[model samples]
Target: MTPAARVSAAIALLDDILQGAPAEKALTVWARNNRYAGSGDRAAIRDQVYSALRRLRSAAWAGGAGDAPTGRALMLGLLRQEGEDVDAIFTDARFAPVPLNDAERQMPGTAPEPVALDCPEWLEADLRASLGEDFVPVMTTLRDRAPITLRVNLRKSDPAHAAALLAEEGIATTPNPRAETALSVTDGARRVANSAVYRDGLVELQDAGSQALAQAVPVADDARVLDYCAGGGGKTLALAARVSAQFIAHDAIPARLRDLPDRARRAGVEVRVSDAPAQAGFDVVVADVPCSGSGAWRRQPQAKWDLTPDRLAELTALQSEILDDAARCTAPGGVLAYMTCALLDAENAAQIRAFATRHPNWTVTETRTSRPDADGDGFFLALLRAPAQTA
Candidate 1:
């Protein structure tokens, strides 16, 4: 497909997304229908659609739309923002979009501050309050694509060795300073899943900050660890790499962990999948609770726009409940690690503070917060310890 045709395809997908279809679903349906579109064409069109969603408000403003912006307006707005010659892409030729109208050609003036920042209007105040001075920079970073990062399975191979193996398979990586086992994929990101290193269980696709969170948890040799809210067992797998621990993976929706067994087998680790919560006490219990996922919006841009105030409140409440439940599975003097990918204070430090307030016996032993950067997405981890029994 020509570049112009890709833009047109992206515009149609964006229209379907704007009409209430999910971005992924819309793109999948489009690809299934257009069998002629090659892998490269589909990837390019997907990128265009995601980029537009990431800057929806700014694109709408740039395209001179009022309340509801059409697909053409969004594409035009994005093109204008990039300072590209709109005529080249929107020619009246077949399979290409029509030329921009007079109104669209009359370049829009400066957009509202929030629109310019590509932040949701409702979330501006809370984001500013949570981030303070760094809100703009962090939000700006989220407007672009997130980097591909992998965590080396230290039990099987180190970062240097993993990099060497990946390089042999036409994939390039650089050691990331954010975490001991992290490797930032510098090239051939698309081939990572097929790389011999990844297929050989030497490396796994995980955020560096997440790897750091798993790394920070105190685990002794032969310690029993329970991943309380394990989804897809990524963190459980990361923990397995750090220590020779008895790992138990449990999620509220057991179906989420259905593939964990295969993943564990591939990585050459033992992870017991549990339908119910851990009945016995564990040395370490990790509750990577669900939240708004505000920090990792670069990868899931639709979530940012889909989140509502009520939904956020619900998530916070759920996080609190999960923390309390996870605490039950931790032995006295054991570590209860609460984590989230949200940057909101309501979900991170504040939740831990509230947990401490409710359960006086528990005390926060360690806390780590990371902002989204080239190394990883924004993440917060607070390790709380259960009180030791008194004689």
Candidate 2:
């Protein structure tokens, strides 16, 4: 498909998304219906749709479609923002958007801070408070795509070895400093999943920040670690890859861990899947609780606009409950690692403080934070030590 055709397709998908269809759903349905659109066309259209969502407010303002941003306006705004030839793209050519009206041709003025930053209006205050001086920079970074990172399964290969193996399969990677085993995919990322290296589990797709969180957890030789609230077992696999440990994964909804067994087998790791994890006394218990997912908005920008204050409040309450439950499973003096991908303090440092307050005996050992960067998404990890047992 031509570039103009891709933009037109993105506009229609954006309209569907604007009218309440989920972005992925709209994109998938469009692809399925238009079987003529090749892989390249689908990828290009998807990129355009996601980029528009990431800059929704800014695009609306630029296109002078305040309050109600139509798909055409958003595409025009995105084109202008990227310094594209707006007139040429919106010409009378086949599959092209209609020529811009006089009103759209008018120069767009600078937008206010929140709109310029593409931040949700309701979230500006809390985001500013949580991010302080770095708010602008952090939010700016989130406007683009996130880097693709892979966690090398130490059980199968080391970072350098994995990079070499991947390079042979047309996937280029550079070692990521966020974690010892992380490799940031520099090129051929689309082929990574299907590459032999990934299929054989020499590398697994995981955020570098997440790999760092798993790396920071203290694991003794032959220790028993329970990944409490382990959804899809990403962190559970990361942890198991690092050491020879008896890893058990359990989720509140048992179905979330349905694929963990196969994933573990591919990575050559032993992981016991338990529905209840009824017993405690785990040497290390990781509670990677869910949040508003603000930190990784570059990957799922819709969440930035969809999140509500009430939903955030509910998440904080849920995080607190998960922390308590995970704490109970940790052995005396064992590690209780609290984690979140949220940029808000309410979910990160604030949650850690609340956990410490609730469990006065537990010690807040160490805390690490990573803002979204070229290497990884924003993440927070707080290592809390359970109180020693009494005879």
User: What local distance difference test score does each model get?
Assistant: 0.89, 0.91
lDDT of 1 by residue, 1-391 (tens): 9878988998998898888899999999999999999999999899999998888888888889844777888888888888888899999788999887787788878887788878988889989999999898998888888889999998789888888989988898998988999999999999998878888888999988889889899999778899999999999999987778899999999999998998888888889998876475898999999998988988899899899999999999999999988988898889999999998999998998899899987889899989998788999999998888611
Stretch of 10 with least lDDT, candidate 2: 382-391
**Tens digit of per-residue lDDT, candidate 2, span 6-116:** 888988999999988999999999999999999999999999999999999999888889658999999999999999999889985899888888999997788998898
Candidate 1, position 147, lDDT = 84
Name the lDDT of candidate 1: 0.89
Superposing every Cα of model 1 onto the true structure, what RMSD results? 1.4
